[model samples]
Target: MSSSRRLTTVGFDADDTLWQNERFFRITERHFAELLSDHADHDHLSERLLEAEKRNLRLYGFGVKGFTLSMIETAIEVTEGRVPARTIELILQAGRDMLSHPVETLPGVRETLERIAGTHTILLITKGDLFDQERKLAQSGLGELFDGVEIVSDKTRTTYERIFAQHGDGAARAMMVGNSLKSDVVPAIDAGGWGVHVPHELTWVLEHVEPPTEHPRFLAIDHLGELSAIVEAIG
Candidate 1:
């Protein structure tokens, strides 16, 4: 990092980086598989659903509603238009349940944020459906810790650059900590910010990417518990 960079603002990724998100999606996916098990095998159904999700990213963006639609689309495709209306209803209900599921923060999240909040301007930078993200943030009860909250459609280099410059000194002085190397780390590092990856147990397949091991601004930690120390060392 350049001497001009002092790690002024720390941008955190919300989904699995802060609280449990992908697990609910997984749970719903299992229900979806069961709903159509007689029509299609589990592995086949899952593959079809993942493909639908990837395809629908642009149309639906990211969130429970899009996932629900994808599940419905997969069910329809696998059944060749014979998917029962009742089954489709059940799939819709599963997505509703996911939306209402409890928000569970990862271990050490609150404590780690508390330790660093006073020292740095922290922001919640996550991409997803606006209303649901807001609901989760409100439910997580960690909302107050963030100086700013950005629920975006996607994470890109320009997104990191603009957000960091607006909230902090600039991208070079900002640190983005999240679970996805593609969404959280690479783009942030590309924008001249430090990228700190905290791997989550269940990341979406679309988010999978090779780590930028040779990038001077890239760093990885086992968990959010290790974040504050990295920030301190950079300062």
Candidate 2:
């Protein structure tokens, strides 16, 4: 990084980055597969659901609403339009349950944020349903720690550039920390910002990507607990 550029702001990705998220979706997915297992094979049902999610990304985007719709679509497809009304109702109930799931902050997230809060401009830049993301933030009781909150439709290099400039000094003065390499890290790196990959146990398949090995500003850490050290070293 250039001398003119010092880490001034850190953008954190929500969902699996700050709190437990994907696991709930996975759990519901398994339930969905079981719901339609009598009509379609379990493995095939899972495959179809994944396909529906991919296909619906453009139309519905991310979050529980999209996931729910995808589940319904997958159920109908796998069951060849013969999916029982009771099963559909059960799927709807599952979606509602997901939407209302308690927000559980991942280990070390609050402490890490508190450590860096006073020093850096901490921004929450996550992609998903706007209301759900906001609700999760409100429920997590960590909204006050963030300088800004961005619920984006997507995360890309251009998006990172724009956001970093808007909330921080610029892309060069920003660092993005998250679990998704494709959405969080790689794009930030391409935007001339630091990319910190903090691996989460259950990552969405679509969000997986190879980390840039030779990038000087790219880093991989075990968890959010290590972030303060990175910021300190950068300073």
lDDT for each candidate structure: 0.93, 0.92
lDDT for each residue of candidate 2 in 1-235, tens digit (9 for 90 to 100) = 3345388889999999999999999899889877877877878787888898999999999999999999999888877898889988999999999999999999999999988887888999999999899999999999999999999999999999999999889899899999999999999999999999999999999998888979999999998899899999998
RMSD of each: 1.9, 1.9
Q: Which ten residues in a row have the lowest lDDT in candidate 1?
A: 1-10
**Which numbered prediction scores highest in lDDT against the true structure?**
1
- How well does model 2 score by local distance difference test? 0.92
**Candidate 2 minimal-lDDT segment of 10 residues:** 1-10
lDDT tens digits, residue span 107-147, model 1: 99999999989888899999999989999999999999999
What is candidate 1's local distance difference test score? 0.93
- Residue pairs clashing in model 2 are none
Displacement of residue 143 (Cα, Å) in model 2 is 0.4
Segments in model 2 whose C-alpha atoms lie over 4 Å from true places: 1-5
TM-score for each model: 0.97, 0.97
Candidate 1 regions exceeding 4 Å error are 1-5
